[model samples]
Target: MLYDAIRFQAFHQDMRIAMIGVKGVPAAMTTGGGIERHVEQLAPRLAGLGHEVTVYVRHYANPRGTKRWNGCTLVTLPTIRRKYLEAIVHVFLSTLHALRQKYDIIHYHGVGPSTLSWIPRVFAPRCRVVITFHSRDQFHEKWNIIARAYLAWGEWTAVRFPHATIAVSHVIQQFCIKLFGVKPFFIPNGVEIPSASIGSDRMKTLGLEPGRYFLGLGRLIPHKAFDDAIRAFRNVPTAMSLAIAGAPGYDMRYAEELYALAELDPRVRLLGFRTGEDLQQLLAHCYAYVCPSRSEGLSIAVLEAMSHGKVVLMSNIPENLELIDHSGMSYEVGNIQDLTRLFTFAAREPALLRERGERARHIVKLHFSWDSIVRQTDSVYESLKA
Candidate 1:
């Protein structure tokens, strides 16, 4: 779609881009990792513009060893499968691999991965090293003290080492300016605004009624705070169901915890991970979507919910607020009472949510389209080249 405007912007040879630190591209609905989804949306569009895009994917994530997906070249590399060591180790090896290849730009996608941003700069002198600071992973409860310290160093080094930095949320952009004194290019996460419902067949399969069940979707991790959503729902005392659609992350314990929690309430349904069409149908037919994440790098989950004309009931975190801009409802972050009250209000006043859902869809259409994001990212590349 972007290529139709300029055809090809590069006057000389097309720019080569190497993307590091994502789990894998052609992001399936199962993984649902934001960075992978972002790359999946971005890489193919970049490739459409006649640029050579190489994405380094994890061996375990890219199990089939896909050489290519859509238009981008997929490079699968090996790494230990441990939760703590997985990201940094893969990023280290990715940088070493990128050193031998001739590329115009090497983009690292996370705070931990950005620690290796300097490596490409040192070895590949002519290549521009770019880092995207999505969120400070150091604060996540899952990380150990040593990992937290290392991630903090990554946030520090990413700003200094990379030729340019991109912040995925306005909150992150402000943080970079205030703490690091470097103003990062603001390129928030993007989504496609669905024109029509793809039908609710999947919802029926899960025994959910159309426009009845509240939806929660994301990786089942501590930071996602799905437990809070469940707790808040318990306080609501409604006939409406709570359907959480997600696969567990490295930790299966959280999933087990959620299964146990769901046992307490018949209305709560843990649907596990829904495929693409199934997820789309769920988004289309839900009562409202809830995203009570404690931390985010500009959540793709929130944007997708908005994109589907669904009113999102999310925590009042800066990043979440920044996306909705009052288009959706919010409760105090991590406050069970506040969330419970909102859920009660939602159950009583479905009409209010219907009104807000229209506004939420409008907001996404006006600001968060993927085509606009690609143009902005391309401009960032242009600046780096000059």
Candidate 2:
């Protein structure tokens, strides 16, 4: 029987909660990027609320087996392979394992591996199931026509099964309504300001002179539009360098294209991946941060830049526009000319950059603080019990 803390406060006080996804919690606790960061932060907070939390992860490359951290348990299941195909197998096996365990609530992330949702509806009908759509995968240009259709179908199924769904941004919520006719609750990603020393000496170590470069940080994927940022940097009158930092995971060919482009121009530097203080240091000394993603569901990278108090020039997508609509910040999603103009403008007026950067930090502190986000998420969990 499931524990009902509010109903039987004295007798059954601990609620068992399970978080389901290809990779979650402990596996995400240390290394992965944004989604991993979400699980790493959220699971511990939920556990702190006196809920017994279990994060289900795919046994891809993880060799740690099962472990406990932050008062939460991580359960890994065997899968077929380490690639995308393995995600499907992982969902099926994880769901089967979850069904055997007694959980009151099941929170699933991403829609790609729809098998997880499909099983929960059939096998764990009594459990309150919540799904969070991190982003619309179909918008990525890397997907072929057939792959796009397949992902769309998976998203449709996953959204339809959940009792309530979460969309990380208003743009994503609208996309859910349009594509799946599901009105998911919106909960934007949040960030915590790093300590002052995090990224202080990044410029010195990278051999970059102060105020001589701009920064672009994210996964090296085509959809991120790194090429567009490079083209815009060419138009700047000052001898400005652009630092591209991220891991090239999805498309090596596209990464090769970016590398070739950088080779032609000495001004562009591609740093494969930087973590810890290195990433912070790079952001700390950057003249400005640029985000040229063609589509985004509230970019964590953009938020990180804002947390560092750097002026950001982002694409005109609704996700970015929702956060930044200031004087110095301007939009250029598809038009290279507009991006060039924005870069030129930033180079000409240094004071405007500082002003915009300060404003960006202020806005983030007001709306995107992690404390407020954890409270909202806690409310969501409490709602399930009610």
Top lDDT prediction, candidate number: 1
Residue lDDT tens for model 2, 263-285: 87788999888876677788878
lDDT of 1 by residue, 215-266 (tens): 9988888999999999989989788999998999877899899999999999
Separately for all candidates shown, the number of backbone clashes (residues 3 or more apart, or on different chains) is 0, 2
Return the TM-score for each candidate structure. 0.96, 0.89
Global lDDT of each candidate: 0.87, 0.77
What's the CA RMSD for each of the models? Answer: 2.0, 4.2
At residue 308, give the lDDT of candidate 2. Answer: 80
What is the lDDT for 351 in model 2? Answer: 86
Q: Name the 10 consecutive residues with the lowest summed lDDT in model 2.
A: 22-31
The C-alpha stretches of model 1 lying farther than 4 A from their native spots are: 1-13
